[model samples]
Target: MSRSTFVATIEPVSTCPVNCEACPVSRRDIEQPKARLMSLAVAGAVASRLRHEFGVGYAAFGNWGEPLVHPQIVELLAIFKQVGIGSLYLTSSLSARIDAAALVESALDYLDISISGVTAEVYNIGHRNGDWERVEGNMHALAKARRESASRLKIGLRWHRYRHNEQQFDAARELAEQLGFEFKPYFGHLGGIEAHEDFERGTLPQSKRRFIENSVFLEYVERAVAAHVGEGSCPQAENLIIHSDGRLLHCCALMDSHKTGIDFLALPRRVLESFKRAPNSHCGSCLAKGWSGFMHSSKVDHRSPAEVAAELAPSSAS
Candidate 1:
């Protein structure tokens, strides 16, 4: 089967500064503390493979860590563009200092700023240890820089909606509009890959489960899980995830331990396509339990829980 679209998510930096509650990178138990930055040479090689071999349409930098933390992030973005990758983007927590003017002038196509709340009290619930003041200031500076330079770089404010932060959605959206940014609000989920693994094994920690039950929109999660039940194929098969160390991941939902062992730079497209067709045990488990669908931001259902339940009733009966 030929895929029409392919995406590559490259991790520019391995370590994150902010300890977000929902992110596995923040948890030492899940993600061992290791600081690694992808060299420009390696990034260029990866970008070449993605463009020349896989014909990747979209490339995203930063999966586990904050891309802005990298001192030469602008150069990294430029590397992908230099390799002819069409759409290049990255998401940032905006907790660290960044050269907004340099970024605006870079080859980046889009920048998504991840924000949980507008205020410190609510923001700290998820973005623990993150400096709200710094994030706010960076947001404004980036907007100003884009306007001043007349850059076409699309800026989006991705607000993670939690139970406590619902009331702050309009305020955040208003701010995004005022800054000429695209406002996107979606329900937050359990942060770590370990959390999803534990949930599947029924061994999720009580504290984590409580966080999900309280903070997340349970109905939306249920619909998302049910909508993909019995799915034999994974949408992520068309996407490639590369670690900062160049390890190729099966998908974003799995841990580093589950990496394919082949360095992305050397892995042939035929080998990756074969691997995608026959996923390992970890990927099998995720697909079987519908967590694969749940993890994708674009797979959510807007229909009510009852409507989704009714649609899935026949499959449940079988």
Candidate 2:
């Protein structure tokens, strides 16, 4: 059966300057000895392959790293557009200096900005070492650029809700709405699937443990685990993640790219699908433990923090 719509997520840049606490990039779990940027030639080739071979209609830039860090980010977007990829989007922390006017002119469909809080103090709790002032300024610049150019580039503010940031949700949402951007708030989790596994095994680093205990919404984690343990296949199997080095990752959840032996430039779609379907140790463990479900949950628990705290109190006491 032909796939209706395949999505390709390519990482134009493979290093992030922002040190978000819940990101593997910040924690140094996914080691990058040196930063890498996908060359225009490689990106164009990958885009072409995704369009012609996989029938990928949608392309998203950014995975473990920030795409804005790349000097040729606009050119990278254009390459995908040139390949006839109908929909293209990218996610960014907006911590780096952004050329908002150039991005507006890039024929990009959407931009999802990852934010933890509106205020610097709370925002720093999750997005450590990130400058809230700079991110805010970038947001404004992008908004102004879109307006001035009359571009159809949709912007979204994805708020990573933590215990300390819930009160700021309304303020952030207001700001996004004021700028004609979509505001999304969801409970944040530990860094990666590896971190999630560590959390379950009570092996997380002391700092990460403290952050999870004090910041994350435990009720959401519990409910997600209850709702989806060994109940479904991995949703990530359908999507493709290409590293900046042109290697195909098993999934975005994977931390060690070296372990993924698949080469994006050479692997056939049928072989890739067969490999995706075959159970591997990492995916097997994540699936069996319900971490896959938790990560991919579509329904957000909108209960107040206090309510969730109350619900989880008994479990914590035990």
Candidate 3:
């Protein structure tokens, strides 16, 4: 991401209680201490930096953590709004105990829900921490709240698919349609090829492997990828991510991993500039041919979730 505009993404926590089947990283995977709530003071510190230094007008509370888990999430949103950056976008698994009405009342422009499947078996297979009945109930309540409140908050459904639930796409899409939300299909890579070599080798057929690696699939999917990229207006140009340790980063995707790039908060702006100016070879590896392809990397980069909510100015209906 180039330029100096700030879009601070705060990751106050990590890992889901449910250990999904396709997930490469769960709360238990990290050897660090248990996920704890971020102190309001820490949130205030990052918010201060964002407003004063970066002129960041957008704040998103989801990245590595299940954002809804924050006890004062509503207060945090109110603080951002009080500071003139309330146009926040929330990304969550909807696993927290908060009410959907409260989330809708926060005046957040976008409420993106991570949903794996509709059926209990399929959904539970990928979302170990999820309860189909509970999520369904919450989502229905959310939709009702949106209608009654007449809020412009747009709800989005993101589905992470793998071999286990590949057959549930139709049902997933139907659920999204039923909810009047857009559905995004994400294919997850189990990190390094060697890490999940046995799993991948066993699950992905030769034909599927060919489709993913083939140049034709890449070309076919690039069109849709371009459209999605265009909609977000390239996050790389306007995004910034703030880690719980008080470090700011160019992209949330790069967070927790030093191999992606330097931490902007820890380094000089010049260093960030130099890093962004350097080529991102990994982007080339992201061909966007299949679901997993998009999850990998891609040439079409965009702003961070923070920047997207701020600069992109999500639609009132979003």
Off by over 4 Å in 2: 1-5, 299-318
What local lDDT score does residue 61 receive in model 3, on the 0 to 100 scale?
72
22-80: candidate 1 lDDT, tens digit per residue: 77776555645357888888887888888887888799887878888888898888889
Deviation (Å) of 225 in candidate 2: 2.1
Clash number by candidate, in order: 1, 0, 11
What is the per-residue lDDT of model 3 for residues 1-318, given as tens digits with 9 covering 90 to 100?
A: 334465667777655565544333442333432466766776676676677666787777776667777778887777667767757888887876777788888757888888767778767655766777878888888888888887788998876644354457667777888888877765433423222333335654333333234211233234434544423123444566665555554444432332354554456666665554443543322322232233335322222334323533222222
**Ordered list by TM-score, greatest first:** 2, 1, 3
- Candidates' TM-scores? 0.88, 0.92, 0.66
Which candidate do you rate higher for lDDT, 2 or 3? Answer: 2
Q: After best superposition, candidate 1 residue 234: deviation in angstroms?
A: 0.7
Q: Please give the CA lDDT of all the candidate structures.
A: 0.76, 0.80, 0.58
**Who wins the lDDT comparison?**
2
Q: Between the candidate structures 1 and 3, which one is better when assessed by lDDT?
A: 1
Candidate 2 C-alpha lDDT tens digits along 1-318: 486556888888878888777777776444552578999989988999988888888988888888999999999999899888999999999988989999988868999999988889988988888998999899999989989997889898887877778788778878989999987776787766878877888987777777888887666677776677875588777677788878777777666643664878887878887766665577777887787877777544456656655765433412
Better of 1 and 3 by TM-score: 1
From the highest lDDT down, the ranking of the candidates is 2, 1, 3
